[model samples]
Target: MPPVSSPGLLDGTGALRTSVEERAARVRFRRAMALMVMTLLAPGSAQLVAGNRRVGLVAFCLWLGLLVTGFVALVVALVVALVHREWIFSMVSNPSLLLVLRLGLIAAAVGWAALFMDAWRIGQPLSLRLTHRRAVVGVNGFLCLSVMGTLLFGAHVVGVARDGILTMFGSDEVVGAHDGRFNVLLLGGDSGEGRWGLRPDSLTVASIDAETGRTVLIGLPRNMSSFPFRDGSPMAEEFPDGFDCDGCYLNGVSTWAQDHEELFPGSEDPGVEATIAAVEGITDLEINYWAMVNLEGFKDLVDAVGGVTLNVRQPIPVGLPHEAHFHYIDAGVRKLDGHDTLWYARAREGSDDYSRMARQKCVMNAMLQQVSPQVVVRNFEKIAQASTAMVSTNLPASELDTFMDLALKARGQKVSTLSLVPPMIQTADPDIPLVHRKVEQAIEQAEGGGTKAAGGTGRKPKATPDAVTGGSIGSLSEGYAANQAEDLGAAC
Candidate 1:
């Protein structure tokens, strides 16, 4: 019966038909998977419809000029973030425009992975079907390794943000904001191996305000002593009538300006410019910038932002009690880490540097209300590698997008604090006109005025059930409501 099948290899319900070179190798294996999906969607449209139209019009005009320059730089960074928002933070803190955007994202990730391997060699794939040339070489090696591994991981996160903004803002001057408020200072220092160089054991200023970022903070009292110096300042011609020489305090004015570096001649950090002229003569206020920090790399910037929720209200002691491995960061409202929040903002045995300056203003208001901006963009490269080995600053990288837009507008207001220490001001003779009239009435009640600022002495002291003291609940001679607060998170 099968011997009767030869009408041009039988058709109408017979067998043996597909022949012209096996139907042109199944239409060249479906045009090699439609030219690797048109070069994974228009990357020089599979070499302008099948290879070399002048190298597909120069890689389709550089991929349509990088998608019209990334949609005109996202519409000029959203119209310069609504007209002049610090010129888009001075063009992304320009380190020569982040080294030309990290060499144009590694030359657009090796020219879009060599145009997806030249659209898989114009999809000829040796006339297909060796399992369709191993499925077009596994879909052109997965679209050239997922578009060159997402532009080489965005050029390694823009070369680690231009080497962490040239290692934490190497300053190029820029000072600005003064009366409308900026202040700064901060400190904390405590260097190592036979100390000498940096001694500031925490000072604090952080004024802020410029336009309603209303901060305040103040604090100062590394055993503050007679202060003065800002007028004709070289530590005011060598402490005119103040830094009271007897192991003079306010953090030993940066080891007495690095032990007299010829009275700061062409100063390159004459001990942080003599501790910013003794914190602008003990807060008569002008300073503008300072920073310092380094408290043993501040516990790797508090374990790189993953550990800071305070309210311990008791058991907080970690080391110094003749430390033979002394511990105890017990009490409640937990989340400590970073060696127990740096020994609960530096625990002093039975705590009293004004209850460790009211537990360092409840750890700077719990790291400015739990470090938000999505925990700084999801732990931004481990908080820029623990802030370049824990901070140091002149504060300039063109004012880090104006203090990151005044720390996101002072995390929705209400910070205010004062703490010169003691029953209102006398860290051994620190009543410098009552610490500059409680720092101009806590910057006139944080700019709006009248809320009984400077730790509102409008009486409200009673609540002391657990009576903790050193770890701080009250009693360092009745003060630590976060040192002085109008609302330092409801006085911690």
Candidate 2:
């Protein structure tokens, strides 16, 4: 007789055994998936049904509390938005509330991830068939890893928010809008190892209309001097004849104030206050908030967004050749990473400070126009981290939401720029009153429709302002590129 040909070693009996085992494996697999799914939907459910009841109950309670909080918050916001939009804005603008929200998000992330892992442990994938066991293990690992990664990232964001509030803010109190516009002073400086302290090179006032998101970036020259101050302010009393003290320049105000700290008397930030006074006097606008950035850290932010695309009109050197490797950032429409972007915003080898000012505006415009919301979300974690390290501001964290809302509105509109550089107003001895008129004109023009490319004196570089440059800041011949422009892109 031919050797018995059967699927199982013990004739057909083994085949039946194999089939029974497979059926049992299917049941186990289904149960495991079910537990995992339940844990995902109602965290801690699997544990409560199986393992440590106390731990499960606590986790479930915590999760329920979070859900209830979320529901309440959503309902409150909706009601507030319908009844009074300002109330909603105010609520979101509170620094304390924002800090709480950030921390909450982090807590939720960590806790949820832990619950997912616990659910996996309760699954007991080892009891499953070899194939089913592997599958269960893989799925549990994937879910736990995914939840942990996402929540941890959120926790990082919350940490960033905390740092931002702690290091950047001074007073949590918000200053109401003035003349329907909120004017914020922007200062860019560096305080790396070799540097002593902040020496703000770039100065601009972003005056935004509350109702309409129309904005005006009024650039002030660092070298400017002889500007007045807000009446009776400490700096004004110190230098009654304008900031006309010996060797005083716009950028020097902060240093001068630091040197003469006694003059401030119990003030929080004398240097910032002095600079604000100078800007207010020049622009004839009240400064509501001020933000400062250590430009060295800006590169990290740029990299976080992957990179920004810009039209490099001229060759920008990355570093000094004599001191280190001199690499020229080749000109043209190119995508620049953080390092290159920082250089683009700060490079001034053969270029004058005024020209760099114009270029800086162009970079701003590029970043504003180019860095889309999608890009921000895609690189949210990195951006949040970089922002915390780079920026320090007196604007309370609560007020950020209000600005963010305005920013969304302003995104669609044109951003008019007016740089107070050479030819139009003498940087060395600027006529304060005339400067005010120029700023007013720029704002009025922007609100009406749009301003001319920051033209007059600094005729912007002759480039097609198709989107990338938002107009030219201008080359040397075009004055200082962005000294003044109705349309920055067109001016560039």
Candidate 3:
């Protein structure tokens, strides 16, 4: 008005208006970038502020649920660990819950990822400048992927954990331990389908001292005969004197029980009960729980753990001596995969059953001594998968943590092994009193240390595996212990 407005260009009003509009566009782009950042940090926040209310509300609710769940889980785990660790193990090992958890994690992953993508759409990157728009698109995509990937991985862990619980754990109710210890009957069998219904060829009792975590491995020969059952047990009533029928060996107890399941009306697992009766009668240790590992299925577990390191004393043949591809794992400290480790543990070529039993003990010792927590964590998925397929146990999930703690203690201490085979206890005609004495002797020796982990008792530092593992197998009667000592390596 003052200068008498010139025509379009001279007026300059059009230019000023265009500049103000451009500034507003730039501000909008900046705000969009900020919103995208907020979305990345707190998924539903962007939508709740500037987009679809329903979607935002739902997304936010899910976020809150996950947050609360994670918090509660952490709190419960910590409290249970301090107050009653058994509950923690039991809850975590529950198969049904684990399955639900796995499915939920997968669903959450997909849902959250979808929400993130929606958030990107709401940002309306098309309205932004070319450079800013491209940048926003890239960030949004990366964040979506990151969130989804993490959740999916969590699902995998949950699945693996569920498999672990199912494979190894059973729904056995927790019963008080026997005689201040947990005597778990370990039965080695050919449990493959159509293998004559679980022919248990090997038996060992893993007697663990509840207080001290000290352990004694009492091996029973499958050919053992003339064994008595625990007093007042179903089997005891059936066989009043002992399992003394002609041609009846300890190994046949399960089959005999299966044939006459009517006798064990009170027992759901007649085979296990019969076997337990035989084991209890022979070892003189009350069986608290039991586990059966299929010998053929054991290779998968070995492979799952990335193979076991064994000191081979002699060449163990892989197949029938004459078959093609028949070879031997020559004597040495060797890390064997599943196939070879199986032969190492089961081979009968150039060896008697008793000798094979001794070798098997060596393999067990090697596995226990060499496998560490670090190794387990590294190959947890494989181990969980293999374990589920290979083993069945009557051990309650509630007791897993207790056993795990005991195992940790045992690793720091020396493990003792006693096999009831040739030159020790006569399998064909075992001297019952003497056998009991031997078992007592082993337990007494293990507990003599009196180092209760619960009391914060200090244990000897673990020995290096390298120094202890490689050697001639027959060089020591007990593979880990030289002859028999509380500390295995020191005695050697």
Give the winner by TM-score. Answer: 2
Higher-lDDT candidate of 1 and 2: 1
State the lDDT of candidate 1 residue by residue for 50-151, as single tens digits. 888887788778888888989999998998788667677678777788889889888877877888887777777876769889988997888789888988
What are the per-residue Cα lDDT tens digits for candidate 3 across 369-443? Answer: 777878888887788788877778888776777887677666676767666664455667788887776677777
Candidate 2 per-residue C-alpha lDDT over 1-492 given as tens digits, one digit per residue, 9 for 90 to 100: 757755434664444435556677788789888888777887888888887889888978888988898899899889877856656766644556767777776677777777777777777777877888888878877887787677776767656656655666656789989988999999997766854234687899988998877888899989888888888788888878888777889898888888889988897778888899888888899999988877888888888888888878767888887756668878788899888888887887767777778778877877887777688778766877788788878887667667776776787877878888766788778878778777877877877843443533224445444322312344444455466776666544
lDDT of 3: 0.72
Sort all candidates by lDDT, best to worst: 1, 2, 3
Distance (Å) between predicted and true CA of 341, model 2? 1.8
RMSD of each: 18.2, 5.0, 6.9
Q: How many residue pairs clash per model?
A: 0, 26, 1
Against the true structure, candidate 1 reaches a TM-score of: 0.39
Error of 1 at 296 (Å): 24
Candidate 1 at residue 303, lDDT? 82
